[model samples]
Target: MAAVTAMLEELRDMVPLTAEGAAGRFAVQEWTPEGKSRDGVETSWHKDGIRGWIQKFRSGAVRVSFAVWIRDVDESGCFDALDAVYEQGEQALATFLPGIEHSPLTGHLAEAELTATDKDEFIAAREWTLDERVLTAGVVQQDTDLPVMVVVALEEPAPASA
Candidate 1:
């Protein structure tokens, strides 16, 4: 069951992640297929502790994700959370904040874009990015996988050839 509550305020219109096999690449964002690297090693990962990964898919898109513990890693709850957040983009993302007296964190940024200003009223531990489309990704989890980690990302295509 997706927590009986709504997702973070920062996210809602988030496009939930589709199901994937264990070995499947959970890629929703675009990436550089060749010339960059064939391995899925995202050296540009800014955030630590469950960092965001950049993949190679010829899209040059980057992925940023945040994790929302489904109270207790429930599959239905994970999908439910994804659905709720998917329905409300920024609003759901905003819901992600430092946990207070709440038992077990319901939401926390597993990924995000950097801030233009050195200081943001939101989560401060995260790195900032000039890209406005960073947090605008979707809420998705590997199908049949642990529901503890919910993924989000943004895509930026490479510049046109000269």
Candidate 2:
């Protein structure tokens, strides 16, 4: 099986976003499930931890995506956590990065952009319990007419049994 490191490395070079750039790449605002003003406050993220990642695919077009997790390595499902983040990120790309008229297999990037703002916002809104966590976010700057989507999912740390 491909080691996790290799998978991460592949994703690292796939897009123009650095871990630090997640904040600026997407203008994500947090909201309550009830739909109230979130004020844009963000949560803290540990350095050297797997905050998240972004990926891109190019064929006739280019597609970009992002996925992030803001939690300690243990409480979250080690392998499962990373997998879920990756999938969520890919889904986001499928929805938001491909431009309105483009497809993942046929979309193209109009420019190079990156940010960490979205990741931080997600961390702030997340409410952890044990087996699951909830996250909220928004996407800005999509080329009208194309079908682009951004998805943000959170996984809370598992609670102790004792």
**Leading candidate by lDDT:** 1
Query: Mind sharing the TM-score for model 1?
Result: 0.32
RMSD of each: 14.4, 19.7
Instruction: Name the regions of candidate 1 deviating beyond 4 angstroms.
Output: 1-48, 64-92, 97-134, 146-148
Instruction: Quote the positional error of residue 69 for candidate 2 in Å.
Output: 14
lDDT by residue for model 2 (20-139), tens: 333223222111112121123222222232222222212212122222222123244466764454455445544433232232212221322223665443322211121122222233
- As a whole number from 0 to 100, the lDDT of residue 81 in candidate 2 is 61
Question: Which tens-of-lDDT digit does each residue in 1-162 have in candidate 1?
Answer: 121112212222333311121002322232222222235343332222334334434544434333432222445656677555434533434454323113132233234455454233322223322233333322333444434233443333343467
All candidates: TM-score: 0.32, 0.21
Predicted structure 2: lDDT: 0.29
140: Cα error in model 2, Å? 14
